[model samples]
Target: MDKQAALHHFKEHHFTPLLESELDKLEAKFHRCQAGLISDFKQSFRDLCAYILSMQQQGLKEPIGYIHYSFLRTQMLEQSYLYMVEAYSAEWYEDDSDCKLTYDASWAYAPMSAMLENLEQQRKIYMGAINSADVERLILESAPFFHSFVDSLVRLAIAESVQSPEYQAIHKAERLLIRTGEYRDISENLYVWDQEPLRADEVFEQLMQSSEEEPYVYENLKSLSLPHLHQFQKDLRYNDFSYSDLRGSQFHTCILLGTRWQQANVEGGSFQGCLLSDTDFRYCHLKGVNFSEASGRVDRENGLRTPGLCGIRFEHANLDEADFTNVHSFEHAYFEGASMQGTRVPRIYQQHWKLSDSQRESIVWTE
Candidate 1:
């Protein structure tokens, strides 16, 4: 069409509102699409970059371990673009009414979708290139886009494997084992300084000092692991002890949810009256611990699953009225005076239990 005819059409159709509306629609689509893919994508990327640079600055001479790199890579490909476009498209169509406007909107979004998908591909390639040195340079150079990718990948890695043993171990060892960044003892909760071990007496003193109004301690307990604490204890109130020490330390009536005790020592630690639901004790020693009074007192606000007392030598451990609905026990696990109502014991033991006087007295073989 000629300019005059187009101008005439514009006048006839009141194109100003339509143009503004289209522009608004396009801008809104871009924002939504971007937002769906990332929250403050640029800022998150910068943070990721800073994290990487900080790691590199630490001058880590040891070779890094191989991670499931493809997991993060595939996640980026799927999340960084695909579902975002589809989600945003549905959102846009839900509001769009006019056919012409809808057509225009579709066109506008089409280019963006294609562009974003390509951008997502590029992100995959870039992040796939991310290794020890490349990750270091991307972080050091402060590449905003790279930062975005790195940030997403880091988060993705955390999200995907947060519950796995490797992730837990890495997290527990993040600070102490991290080759990046200089060690800073800003908070007693994050670092386990060999030079500044919290002595048993000091721990008791700290626990008893209720009147001094102890200062708030913000420790990055992300890497704080205590897989073998023969007798580690600290005041457990509003303190982030996600990976704190619990090795032979007796935790009494303390609230410890979301605390990281992965592979930490809890051997002989009396957890009487302590709230310890959902706290990781994987691969940790729990032999002969006094959990008789501590079984049912777990903090349930965090929605963690009931923990298994299996592998932890509960020899003569009083578990009266304790909920062992899913706890696995070996044949030798003693249950003298232990409640078996709804407590799952091995099937083989179930037959052997029939021969016992208690089973004979408890069971009535009536036709």
Candidate 2:
């Protein structure tokens, strides 16, 4: 489908009205506080949290829902901080001296604190499934609001001398959100290699010139042997690297989605923090390969329902510190002679696969 048509489909079918409804509710609550109709800040905060959770649960049911919900959640969080900054007065902080804000003789700090934590937890859960372009779009859409919100918060905190624990926590949360957005941008733009063929000497020159900050793309390099190469943080997605010798290659934080490494020799390669979801590594030599913090799982229940590590091989491989969280049918993958020391395999594998005692001992359960 064309780009416009695809976008329309997404907005119509996947993006639900429920998101906008919840956002409207939250905004109305904030407006009510501004009008001084709500004296109990804690009750308003509780209602805001309830709306956020309701939106999150709806997103958990589908991929498109999750994307829309994520964007709206960020906006709501910023709004919540804005409301708190506006509701409490400078005299309120000075009078307490204990950094606690109260309304109607009740502490009003716990709900806001809990809301920030819940937002972060949800972000982490859905991050791996999020598309790179979607992340960029969300960041762009929310940039203006986020900037203004932070500016206002900083000004308010300085004006009121609000160095309370709650203020500090909000500051930290804002910083984390900004940092995570930067990381997402970096991850999205890490692959930029030409798709042309060249002589062996030319290829070697390109590889040598590449660095982790500016990674070279080998997406079109098929059936070629590239052993002991330092192609760290490269974008090798949707390529056919089948029958290639890629032993000891550095692929840290690389994107390898839908890439074919079938029957390839990838021994001792480091794929730390790499995106390997839907990647085909069938019959490949993964001996001593490190997949630490690498994600190969699809959102099966909500998205495409793709199987993780399907038909992949780990014959005599070192899987130390590898994480297989949310991986589907991972037990179906071949693991003959593989070392799973310190590996974080998913619980689904244990219940489905009849693993040997030695194999069980090698793996560490996440739960």
Candidate 3:
């Protein structure tokens, strides 16, 4: 169609609304067209490109008074842009380089510059994904960028998890814990490289020695071998650790969903403000573990869940009025406001409780 005719048709058909209605379709079509740049699809590409440019030019600001959501679309658009470029690279033909490229036929940069920009963006996203919400999606979108991005994410996650407001008190309260002193049981050479303990100064020294702060260095140390690192690819997703010993470790506000802690010794550990849903702590030792503010020790007026035993083992431990809901065990467990539902404890421990048969059945074999 001629330009005048096309313009007339656009106006006549309510083009802007039509385009907006099919924005997703247009996006897909443009992505496919840009990849291959087939001659027949050029017009469709041009129209779509024009619409995006027009929208950008109109300066669409976010909703009124939202600090967080303003940055929300940034990550989404970034992810879309990455996929778009990757598609462009896969379908780009050399002969088309001489001609200006367009999805909507509006003028954009040259093909070479576009490719360069894509590479630059890929690098920037690789670096930024360390502390980004789109880290998971970005990792999935660009598997090639994994080596650079993964470690940064893992370290950042670890660092964030281990640093919380309750860290100081928890750490101080946990000093009475005696180390097994088994001398490095984990096969991953956790003690091999420089063997620097992860104190603040030590970590700072290591970080300063490197020009850039890359989190992968910690990942490498955690896994020592390529095979182990590869295992981490799947394992890292849910922090998938089952029947593991995570004792004396400090975890801050971290994600620990779907992790297995069966029969594990997490003694003297601190898990402040961390998400621990769907985690299995069956038969695990939680002695002297400071679950501060997490165990419902605070009063009900504080609007917190009441302490109820849940899926946790508390053998020979002191849980002074800490919250315990849906906990696993209270076998031989000691506490003040903490008693048992299905807890199998000694008669002396439950001397305070007047239990019915069903409530009594919750405990298997109490002392």
lDDT of 1 by residue, 259-307 (tens): 4444444555665555443333433444445543333222112211123
Best by lDDT: 2
Residues 312-361, model 2: lDDT tens digits? 44544456555665554344355666667767776667776555688899
Best by TM-score: 2
Error of 3 at 175 (Å): 38
Scored by lDDT, model 3 comes in at: 0.29
Per-residue lDDT of model 3, residues 303-360, tens digit only:
1111211212233233222233322223212232222344433444345444445444
Ranking by lDDT: 2, 1, 3
lDDT values, one for every candidate: 0.32, 0.43, 0.29
For each candidate in turn, the TM-score is 0.30, 0.36, 0.23
Alpha-carbon error at 309 in model 1, in Å?
18
Distance from true location, Cα of 13 in model 1, Å: 43
- 129 in model 1: Cα distance from truth in Å? 53
